[model samples]
Target: MGKIKKRLKNFKAPDALLLICILMAMVSILTYLIPAGEYTRFLDPETGKEMVDPNSFHYIENTPVGPWKVLSSVHQGLVESAGITSFLFIIGGAFGVLNSTGALEALISRTATRLKGKEKLVVIFFVTLWALGGAFLGNFEECLAFLPMQITLCLALGFDSITGVVIGICGVAVGYIGGVMNPFTLGISQQIAQLPPYSGIGFRLVLWLATLTVTIVYIYRYADKIHKNPQLSLSYEVDKASKYREEISSNIEFSIRHKLVLISFVLAVIGIVYGVIVFQFYLGEMAAVFILLTIVMACISDKPVNETVNAFVNGAADLLYPCLCVGFARGLTIIMMEGHILDVIVHSLTGVLGKLPSIVSAPLSFIVISIINLFVPSGSGKAVIVMPILVPMADVLGITRQTVALAYHMGDGITNLLSPAEATIMVALGLMKISYGKWIKWFWKLVLLWYLIGIIACIIAVNIGFGPF
Candidate 1:
């Protein structure tokens, strides 16, 4: 027993690459055990995307995945994920070039000086802002653009790197759960369920407030502890390099070139956000903006052509590991889909939930969505895939469609924290150099708390008849 406890304490997360491989291999095995099944797919009139028809469930002949095919899926995943993989590369390279300029550190130095004594207030403002973004706008991938900057700020503000990364991710994550007006998750799910647009937002707003407050306070408490006792941080050992940053002296001037590059980045981010929300730009377009920003930064700095090109290339190269991890993660989904077991798993899980009591079924719906989301992480995509089946299932079980949507929103939101298959989350971890194991160790407590609150909220929503149906 003592030996067993020692082994458990010493366990570390498998590297990102190995974790994806293990999961992919596990999923391949499941294809054999779970019967092959499928639901008919049709285009959604509103979203102009293909959606599974809930009533179209049917079992087909088993399509067992072979070892050779499973091995081949690694390549297939990269091919399928080419678009996102490329976008991640550009994101890394863009930030890498910016880091090379030392602008973020300079800016953090200035900002940290102003907030010298108001560290808790600083945490509250940024965490709330990001949470609002996730709750109101479905801002998951877009939020990744801000983590590196936040890491620098957190370190400068006397917090550890984990605190920096958490501040960036946790709020948006909570907001994803609250999902007040988030189009990607709740909006699409509700619309598919044939409910009123953004119905039950009053309750959602309350959830958003409650969740945001919990996360903010949680992050602050952690920040306060680590700020005083730096040794207490999970990232403390690896953080020394980032923690004891060379203090930027107040008298040292930020050069004109640094200001130009920094201003261009800020404007570029604002423009990208507007383009994404208003013009509906996606991964490809976002990549273009960063590519453009890289050129602008290079030119404005008046550096030699060789230096600029080298910096851009090196920056992109630095992100190679995370980008490959995204490909492998995408491959896992490909293998499942190729083996024709994706629908079967969904069918199996929902069938079990459909038999439970309404209150129990409602909370289990959250768990089911969370499971499926590991295979399908895209917000709107998951909504399209699962909501069709879950919406109707909820009806027969006497569960509200609004409640189902809430479950999907909350479940999907929470899994994004731990899903290595998620592109932005992977890169966000890459930014901090934190392994998945370390993150899980530190993060599971907050997630457990959120889980409790989520179940209780779902019960309340069901009791009070949350819906426009």
Candidate 2:
């Protein structure tokens, strides 16, 4: 009990739930402080997409949400975000069903026994696999389905939960920020900027490689340090209480049923990747695949239907806190939209960026967008909102529009690891039971390094006139 208290002390921020409520209140107050304004949106004939008119900015009547409405917005946020909310629930329940078969455990045990001395290799392999998914597929939220499994694998290998988190979440985040071929951020931003799809691939490829290299090295060192001395881990106390540790054992059996389950798991994952790339499957489709996987696993293990249902329910029950975190985070966006200050904030920031000289503006574009990401966490959403204005701004300032897109993508992705406004990130933190403060304490230095890399990439893009424009 004393040990638990010591671990709780390391969580320097308020509980995740309280911190979200505090954010809700703060955004509500901004509804009063910030003037209400909006930009007119129009459909782009070229892209068939709705985009903000760079010229339209007008004050609207202030609609400051009071404490009562601020409180009520939580339900509205959940309703507004019902698709993703349901997606989390479905996946949680599905994974719950999958966990009942004992296959995941036996696989983890067998693999851990064989790879006992090659822990670093395991980290590198999984991190790289996740990075590829992010870089090529624009995968962030989808990665959550694998977080518990990855964390378990790391734990079985005698590393900490933070190590699993870095492997799963941070790996994907860096890949996303690199944005080499990510259709969501880089693709949409390019189309909006009037560049051919993937026009400046060479530069982005180099940037992706550079950023990923740094991420891999940093993650490996941390994993290595923790593996050597578990006491050195920041989450040492929290991890000690985890049930996953109990699954680690040398005498674990790897039965035929487990092998069949493992094969089915691999095939299901492969099918998901194929469906995502070939058919553009989103959350709904991915959820269906997981449900199918769960059923298949249950059949292979010959688990009774009643037992399976109970396991599914129990598994989903575990994810309630994370789901609430996501819903509350969505409420923050709802307040901003209702207050009509979201556009005003963007317009104001762009006006400041427009005034800066070209050299300063180039890199500063990255910094500005990074700041903006706090409010608009969606990459494609920001592309439509900010790109239309930035395109012309880049032209006037003699900065390549490609550089502007690079700035947009980099700025859009790097901060996701820390932003409470991001649903998936908050979900990841909730799953790991890590506080935002402790996350910052662990991740800030690496994020700063990524920011520095982004700044330098911006400067290089500027000096070299990166473009086929």
Candidate 3:
């Protein structure tokens, strides 16, 4: 009993995130089990009508035939989960190999060594790197590789590790939300809405820059605080610093295989840039190309081909659990839509707040999305569900779709830093040995501050005619 209690006592923030997610899933399941009216009707997208079916066990109007139909729907969830997990795994593995080969380490070391006297500048540099990486790469999971390096840089500059992780993750989260030309979410969402292909790039680009600036400034101020008073930082621990230093010093070898990986990585970047600029490949297709390139590079490195394949497979496998969790979360949305819960919630909220001006409407949009995030974590998927409703609502209130989009982005990005639904944040908290309560205690203030800034920025942008009509 004592041993169990001790173990629970030591449970970290990531564990808490996982626990919260599981609890949410349980709630979702309970909601499904409860009897609800009008859940028998499924909407026909093409006909713009809801079709009712008496049978709960059979298919009707191409929607799941009944509540029990979700059993078969699990297959669809598994397939989608597998695809996302596998992709994340491969990307994460490639990033891990790149780090193991010392490319990432070398870069971090060189940069950190040079910026010894300018800690605030270093923070800005990492914020920029992570922001651009998220915008161009469109892979949030891969930020895991860069995170430890940022923590190390922060420690080297006498700052807390939390500072680095928060800043980097926030920057990436924002970039992912404000993705300018990202094919995954933005492209797919626009396509679903029948918007012209990439027509909103100009607006997205401006929003991206504005959000990036706010993030950079926020991080710089925090970094300045740590630089001036390292002793006061919550994340500062002498033993932690010593341990990290020892690890870095022990693994400083720069092998020829690393050089090959770096060269191939450079070529892959050039190819992606060309594809985006010249061939105009969508972000998802571009990601496929980059993953292929990384696989080839891994094979060509000093590691045996079979070993490289195994490494990649192992990497991909790591993502399975989180991916499934996300899918299960999606299942809740499926259930809600079928159960008329979505309409109920949407109808209630819209009825209450549908009459506000753009300024109030914008912030309310963010709040609604943030609340929704508790149930749906996938930004792209959530956008599909929320944007259709919010956009039209915004239009009725004389707000532009772009303003609505920004609200969606802010809601999505802000909660990611604090939400248990975000698996990557859980993974990161686990890696850092930080408790969820502790991390929230440390970061919630920053998250709230950034959320306010982001909301204000969106309002300002909309007023200045930066929104898409």
Write one digit per residue (lDDT tens) for candidate 1, span 1-469.
9999999989787877788889888888888888888999998676788999888889998888878888898898889889877877787678777877767667777777778788778788888888888887677777766776777778777888788778878988988999999988988888888888898989989988888888888889999999899999888777777532546556545788889999999899888879878998888888899999998887787778787777677767867877788888888888888889988878888889978999899988898888888777888888888898888888898888999999999999999987877876777666667787877878888988888888998899789878875
CA error at residue 47 for candidate 1, angstroms: 4.3
Each model's TM-score? 0.94, 0.96, 0.69
Worst 10 residues of 3 by lDDT: 54-63
lDDT of 1 at 233: 85
Error of 2 at 246 (Å): 3.4
Instruction: Arrange candidates, best TM-score first.
Output: 2, 1, 3
Candidate 1 segments exceeding 4 Å error: 45-47, 242-247
lDDT string for model 2 (350-442, tens) is 889889887889889998888889888888888899998899989989999999999999998887876788888788787778788878888
Q: Model 2 residue 156 lDDT?
A: 81
Q: List the residue pairs that clash in candidate 3.
A: 13-435, 13-436
Question: Which parts of model 2 have CA positions greater than 4 angstroms off?
Answer: 1-11
TM-score (C-alpha) between model 2 and the true structure: 0.96
lDDT per prediction?
A: 0.83, 0.85, 0.61
